[model samples]
Target: MKTKLFSALATMVAPTAMTVGSVSADAVAPQTSKADFSVVAKDPTNPTDPENGTLVLKSVPSFSFGTIEASEIYAGFTGKVAKTAGALEIADIRLGKSDWSLTADMAQFTDDANKLTGAILNLDSTGSLGETLTGAVKDDSPAVEVVKGNGKHGVDNFKMEAATLTLAANPAADLAKDESFTTTINWNLSSTTPTAPTA
Candidate 1:
């Protein structure tokens, strides 16, 4: 009876089994990838891979005065003025200034050794965006302000025409033959209205 009573007391006093081993665990945090962003101004010659907010000189025309006859030269030839060829197209975004102006040099036709003696280029831009020109001008002269606009800052085209052409009498009196001449038209752009350069 004593043994049975001691066993009952020990069972009531003993505690339950417990686990104390180390537990393996790991934690995770959330984050995002980072990189630098920017835009750079570049020449617009090629538009294949253009990025956003890019400005480019899209297209321009090559003016050509076709073959002239001796009879026409004697009477002073005049060629047709048309924009059948491409016009000047400028592709701009809102990144450019709200206003812009264009300046171009009045080019003179000349060959390797001789200039067209009395040839004239009349740019009659009276009602157009360009300046009206009615006289002969030097090639190396200061660029002439041709076009100006206000409050328009985006892609657009400008038409160019040759109002008239007067050829000089043949000084050499030689038989009529093919003659080719080229002139460089230097173009300038400005954000503000450009004043005509003083002589």
Candidate 2:
């Protein structure tokens, strides 16, 4: 009986084949994420447009320059697009990135007849939320730097109370009668925040 009791005690005291197991957790593939930015379309000018990929380029101002008369020495015209007329708008929702900017480049003014020779459009813009966006698009010489994340988040929309477009047409350029002179101001959205151009 004593021997049996001793055997039982020893068996109970013996460490049961100790085995250690480790637990761990890992991050999934694709690691971090990214976002896509875009310049909002001029036409339709819809901020809530479902087609705006990643919800970028939400909206922009539309300039409605009334009528222009032909001139021989060159004539100048100006148009205003106020915030009421869809002020410049942009939206960004990117991950792992926040720095962004916008630039403007005006294409040549054209119509059904031909290009408006020696014609140029000068763009003057400003931000509503106190952003320095004073820039222009002179003959496509590096799209004028419009705005960046200057002390504001990339997603922080910088609306403008007003924007000015000055149109100077060539003098005596065979003024087409009742012809519609049209042009495009390409608004580019970029990832890097470029330096706000001097003057």
TM-score of each: 0.51, 0.56
Estimate the Cα RMSD of every predicted model relative to the unseen true structure: 37.0, 28.5
Off by over 4 Å in 2: 1-44, 47-55, 77-84, 93-97, 118-129, 154-161, 192-199
Steric clashes per prediction: 0, 0
lDDT of 1: 0.35
Give the range where candidate 2 is weakest over 10 consecutive residues by summed lDDT.
4-13
lDDT of 1 at 81: 43
Candidate 2 C-alpha lDDT tens digits along 1-199: 0000000000000001101111111110111111111111111124233221122444554333333334321464445232223455544444333455666555455444445433333445555445666665554355666676444434344444454444455554444344344444455555542222223
Q: Ten consecutive residues with minimal summed lDDT in candidate 1?
A: 5-14
Segments of candidate 1 deviating more than 4 angstroms: 1-54, 70-83, 117-119, 124-140, 161-176, 192-199
Error of 2 at 122 (Å): 4.1
Predicted candidate 1 versus true structure: per-residue lDDT over 20-68, tens digit per residue: 1111101111111111101111111112322335333444434444334
**Candidate 1 versus the native: TM-score?**
0.51
